[model samples]
Target: MKVLVFLLLIITTITSKGWAQDCLGMTLKAGTSYEMSTFNAKDKPTGKISYQVKDVHKEGSSTVMDITAQFEDEKGKQRTPYVIHYTCTGNELIADLSGMMQSMQATAMKDAEMKLKSNKLVYPGKLSVGQKLSDGQMEAEMVSNGNTMMNMNMVMSNRQVESKAPITTPAGTFDTYKIKSDMSFESRVMGIPIRNSMQVVSYRVDSQIFDIKSETYNKNGKLMGYTLLTKAN
Candidate 1:
């Protein structure tokens, strides 16, 4: 269950800075689909997730896309469904933070109203060696069924572009920027403090606003799991 929480914290929709139109360059071709898989530290398959482009609308220089994400359980039954919007205008790509966290809050607390105080970074306009960008902060409070449940705050202080490389996977080869970030999370429940942090290495490609691959680690610096792009168009 803890693993699940760690994974959901980074369940990002897209990338960018300052409400800029930053995107993963993910093919906005309508009707195209991509499947990504999760693997444990040993490379054992654990779960599957998919994203599909539902619609695309061109509004002058910016393009708006409707995307649906589906998560399946071990038995292949869809357990989670979410929808988000992305705008590709300017030189960057941006995602609706409220929209991106809707599903996450729903999963975290049933029938709770959520307000996201932190913004998410999906992509930036540029990347270079040793360049670091602030990914921003996310804070939310959840009250479920009239009971005050919990509050969460996570901050991504900086993202450093480590290098550019060609990553080959089942989906194909993609030119990617390897970006690293340190994220800290804190929560309070019944006056008990829960704190943790993790290291993330995300492979972002010019072809998509979504990460081509993502790796996660625990605060102890142990590699816990990773995600791989299996199919994308």
Candidate 2:
């Protein structure tokens, strides 16, 4: 009888933890593709966009992601191409630039690690949107030169727009989350102070039992982009 009670307690704990995460971590291999659209200052359709396969990798907390992405300019010229190496620990995600990551100037990856370890903007409870039914919201910050650079709050709202049950695809099986977030950023690039606001709706798929998909929209309710993530297996 004592043994039975202990087993029941263990099961309960595991169940709770599993349901607590919207994007529970997974270890698998995958290929990802992304499309980016550029806009003009007047909010006019610039008719300029680019697409690429970011990378292929095994993804999880103990796993590191190898990423390569390319961006194009208004004239269809390649610009600001980057390769990134990153890992996710629970809800916290960190990335370090590959090859010559750290230079005379600090890299973005270094800043991400410091911010995570110090637990600055990490929401302590369940992540949700605009005063929903969850305990905690998603938070993020930027760090550079081992100093806090930017702070932001992420709140997810609305319901899953597609696929009610967890989805299973070639990428992997994952639970899906359709989230809308408000982003604010402050930075100094080339000695110029910059502040901007971004509103996004994302689909966070927990790639343990299904693939995740997110479609982003702008403040004017215009479709911005969509992301489809397939876990590497």
Candidate 3:
């Protein structure tokens, strides 16, 4: 449903990161935290996502960061928190998509047996205008009491670095790369099939583990919602 779409959009926007290479200008540090506020099309506050860096270490040639993330509604009622990992190498940064399922587990698919498989999201160290990025995909199934409840599939494609820009948020002003991508979602609940698609425009700063801002739009280019970084430390 709509909740599922919003959760997927939140996951995509929050998972981008970087390191100390052309693609990354700095490394993730422990004890750092960031908060992003979500708003509806009318700019009404809806929910929030918070992240805390819990650990950072080296794994062979990669730097790995463990982060705890929590989602809360407008009223401050929080869902279950979960851990997600980000891996940074000299060439690019990658985010594990498996952890994203936890959001659904806390909402739409509560108490349902779930299975998920996904391709990690990648951000190349050297982003330039017009650079085409790799696509990402995810598929999941939920079952309960020996009956299939829902099956979902999502694809993010047409990714490209559109330009460099400065964006200002509650956290502060940041020099960022403006990236664009298209997303499609398909789900089957009971015997009915539902499909949705949207376009996302996100602004990310070098050396940061989160986006400065992200906007979602419907197929006709109407703004649907947006998320903005409100705090960082």
Candidate 4:
């Protein structure tokens, strides 16, 4: 039973299906663009991030995603990355944020990978309106080389992520579901070997159109950070 549950979570996280009409088969619409207007913890509307995506090419069963974005950092400086590469196999998705990280000192990429693995949250089969996917129940530990990281148990769910980032203008809003999950991982930063339980809440949104919104929150149930789909080709 435990193995079955874990396998399901892995599949859901890896596949992350949806966007059949907009993304699959057809190439990304040329000149596609969008923007993310971020908000601080106070929810005070802050700066903005803009992206332009182009479909470089398609190979076999994968669609190549080329993305670039411009945003202001905490120090109020405007910066943009060259481009981030991502690919989608059917409904599964993968992104490379290392390029973006070069300009900004954010831990977003690392956090994203961890969140992807930990949350294991995605739509069950296809992407559509009013569809929901529950990972049922999962319990595991962060292990490395047969060493214990942390023991955790959680129920992860995923719905359609809506994108509200604007295209014509360089600003917009994104809204998504509040994911209520629980998990534990080895505390590498904390330098602790003890197990700790965390009640995880990941914020996300789906737009009226086809863009997706995804964000991460701390245990306080506040928006610690987020990921936005600013553009698609």
Per-residue lDDT of candidate 1, residues 1-233 (tens digit): 35235344334242221122324444466676888887778988777788887777767888787778776655777645777676777576766545445666656665787766765555666667787776756677777677667677777667889998888889988888998888787887655778888888888865675678888877788987888788876
Point out where model 3 deviates above 4 Å: 12-23, 145-147
lDDT of 4 by residue, 124-221 (tens): 22333344445433333344445553343444333332322322322344444444444443323224544333343334333222234334344466
Identify the leading candidate in terms of TM-score: 3
Per-model lDDT: 0.69, 0.36, 0.79, 0.40
Better candidate by TM-score, 3 or 4 = 3
Q: Estimate, for each residue in 1-233, the C-alpha lDDT of model 3 and write its tens digit.
A: 56654555475422234332222676466777889899988999989988897777777988887888888889999988877888889788888766667667667678898787674788887778899999977788888998989888888899999999999988889988999999888888896999998898988866777788988888899998889999988
Clashing pairs in 3: 23-125
219 Cα displacement, candidate 4 (Å): 1.9
Sliding window of 10 residues with minimal summed lDDT for model 2:
5-14
Candidate 1 Cα misplacement greater than 4 A, ranges: 1-27, 58-61, 97-100, 145-147
The best-first sequence of candidates by TM-score reads 3, 1, 4, 2
Q: What value does the lDDT take at residue 160 in candidate 4?
A: 32
Please report how far candidate 2 places residue 4 from its true position, in Å: 57
Candidate 2 lDDT, tens digit per residue, 68-102?
A: 54444446665344444445455554434221122
Compare candidates 1 and 3 on TM-score and give the better one: 3
Worst 10 residues of 3 by lDDT: 14-23
Question: What TM-score, over all chains together, does every model reach?
Answer: 0.82, 0.39, 0.88, 0.47
